[model samples]
Target: MASLVKKTKKPALQPLSFHSHPTMPPPPQTTLSTVLHLVLFLLLSSTTTAISTSQDTSDLEQDCTNKWIHIRDLPPQFNLDLLKNCSEYPLFDNFCSYLSNHGLGQKTYNDSHSWYRTDPFMLELIFHRRMLEYPCLTSDPNLANAIYLPYYAGLDSLKYLFGPAVNSSFLHGLDLFHYLAHQDSESIWHKNFGHDHFLVMARPAWDFCQPLSNDPPIFGTSLLELPEFYNVTMLTFEARAFPWQEIAIPYPTSFHPSNLALFEAWINRLRRTRRSTLMLFAAGGGISANPNVRRSIRLECDNSTNVSLNGSITMKYAKLCEFVDCSNGICEHDPIRFMKPMLQASFCLQPPGDTPTRRSTFDGILAGCIPVFFEELSAKKQYKWHLPEEKYEEFSVFIPKEEVVFKGLKILDVLMSIPRAEVRRMREKVLEMIPRVMYRKHGSSLGLRSKKDAFDIAIDGTLQRIKSRLEDSA
Candidate 1:
């Protein structure tokens, strides 16, 4: 898969405090595009050898048909059956919804020229479909580098997690383990003890960890807890510290560029667009028991709004009590209503939600907005595969939640104190990250000038990890 790159053991990050150093001197001023150019130059140089001008599906298919990765074509019970009914996908008696525009959902927003608001939970469907378009896909296991288990484990487990009748009896989880147990030396599981195998899930690590642990006893399953999964890689939205490595991936956003032109247009637009709002927080509050600092930050944003600053600090959809229905990858496909605020904001406040990590972090970064993080684990501790091995302040703004709640620190002033040049530099860094953090719809070909995107990085990193692990064992 790859030669050698350290894939295990990520060093802990020193917590960054975005101090309101009013007298802080600005670093050397660099144009936003210059930073972009430097970053792209480094990346392009590294990947120039692998970047092909025309990697059409036909060539990739022919090349990989018997020499890349083999996909296990499971029965309807594994994948197809889950998608047969959109309503029952998350639950048996769920909402009846139709998927238009090839599972991206019908574009309800008027602004088709710029961006569209797509559902967040459709990642499982999107990824599974996109996997078919992967150049490394092969039907024959005989000529394969690794094996892909295209199981809708996240979708399948969602039923048990959100169902009305909950129990520890996860039939789907048990059934999968039983199937794996029956594998012989000819099976992919027998190939290096399933070290070269992987499966992608749209949900976080907690969804699968939960085994009806709540006092009221919400539905939870024990799928990942099974001993059989210890050797296999689990690709999830938020990677957990399990026996085997769990890879973190960006949540599926509305913007899935079909071509390089569209991708370039989006990045250029973000670079030139004038951000009217100083900071915006689009997260919901009062969703959990403690609700943590969300409620506090929401109040602060509400109190600090001003017309003169052109909506300096804004908060939207703060409480998500009614948002439980869409928790299982079944959200309204359109997200532009929420995305507009992100597009207009200079900095987006991203606090720790149910977990330290939030999908909105990627959304804010993709929208070219500098993110303000409260916790180290949100992006710093997590996303080792996607984020750089450097301090969090390089691409994001970090202020401890205590300062906003008790220390009486003004987030707006703190962020505004940052030099304009530094802000542009950070925003440019965020824009430069678009290609790496986003998942392009790589149908048939990786498209023209396909700069290494989130999909490319994730796959390449996982492959190298496997190779490194196998070699160490050897």
Candidate 2:
């Protein structure tokens, strides 16, 4: 089957407190008799009006504060059937394995606290499970502030991506929209024409967008172009600059902590780990549509050391760099292998792969290795809701791709030039960003110490965006 499996594009690379005040007493009954009675009635009427207004305001505040998410009861075909029939498809030959543990993949090892072999393609499942555990989920659609479409769009696209029929690529998505359009007039999609509804697309947005004539014809579907989905928000791993409907989210990493304590412990481990190597690059170079960047990085790795054809850097000739050569495509499926190298390195090289983004970027952050970006869209242009745009330099370094790939600039020189104190500061900022870039276990509870993780940030951002969109239209 030509190993239809994609060579893992290894990267290179607040609580509200309510206070109530007691109502003031009405003026004492003055002894004007009839005048007094009339004045008393007026005062009481005004007081009642004030009380009613206050109650309405309180109700409004409560509603505004609670972010209610309603999951649609989509037909099993849109979600469950995809899983049930996963084993039948050659494209999904190993897909069923990733469905374990609520789509967080298998555990890295027995008794491992916060690690998983998460597949980047399994995001919709993780998100669906997390949405199920959402604190403010509502059973009634009318009561929901945001609607969640529980369709496994990512999984559903596999057949199209791998099938021989290019023209049939969009049929399933078309059927999905048709199904949605046929729903009752009062259904969620009909309400605002799905403006407030959102779906998680584990793949990049381009997979669902219309492909250009010169582009690879078998790459994607026309789902993104369908009018039925125009207003629907898409939470994807990568998003385009236009179509503000798509929001880029952090790619799922190997770390899925069970609670806040474990999350904190992981950060602490990253802080205390001793990094001996100046930089690490763990990604595949054999199979990628976009190989120029990795080729440049691999060339640097090879020329710097007596690298074997396998691309491994033997310590005999190794100096400032370490390469976990993934040319065979192993690290893409098992990211844990990259962990040891990343933990021992001060910086993780994150060059764009098949797309502008790489799963290794999140993995690098998780390991507390400051990321070095060769492309602006790789990190700076995405994840606005999770990563602070103003704080990129605090945690990451940017060296333009042209400098290294075309100009032959040494990545080591730029990194070594950074002061140790500044490096430490950057590492600290990277650690601070750990929680925001990960998706904690769906049901994980951290009590009073709980911080907002990726899932929380995504839902909040979606709701806020939907609210603004609704208001603008209103």
Q: TM-score: which candidate is best?
A: 2
Model 2 earns a TM-score of 0.81
* lDDT minimum window of 10 residues, candidate 1: 10-19
TM-score of each: 0.75, 0.81
Query: lDDT tens digits, residues 5-98, model 1?
Result: 1111321111111112224332222333443443344234323322342244776666543336666655557755665444543433332232
Q: lDDT of candidate 1 vs native?
A: 0.60
Q: What are the RMSDs of all candidates, in order?
A: 14.2, 17.7
* Candidate 1 ranges with C-alpha deviation above 4 Å: 1-67, 89-102, 109-117, 169-172, 183-185, 211-218, 241-243, 286-291, 305-332, 442-449
Alpha-carbon local distance difference test for all models:
0.60, 0.72
lDDT of 2 by residue, 41-120 (tens): 43353334334433334555575464767777677678766665445567545565566676776655444556666788
Cα deviation at 437, candidate 2, in Å, is 0.8
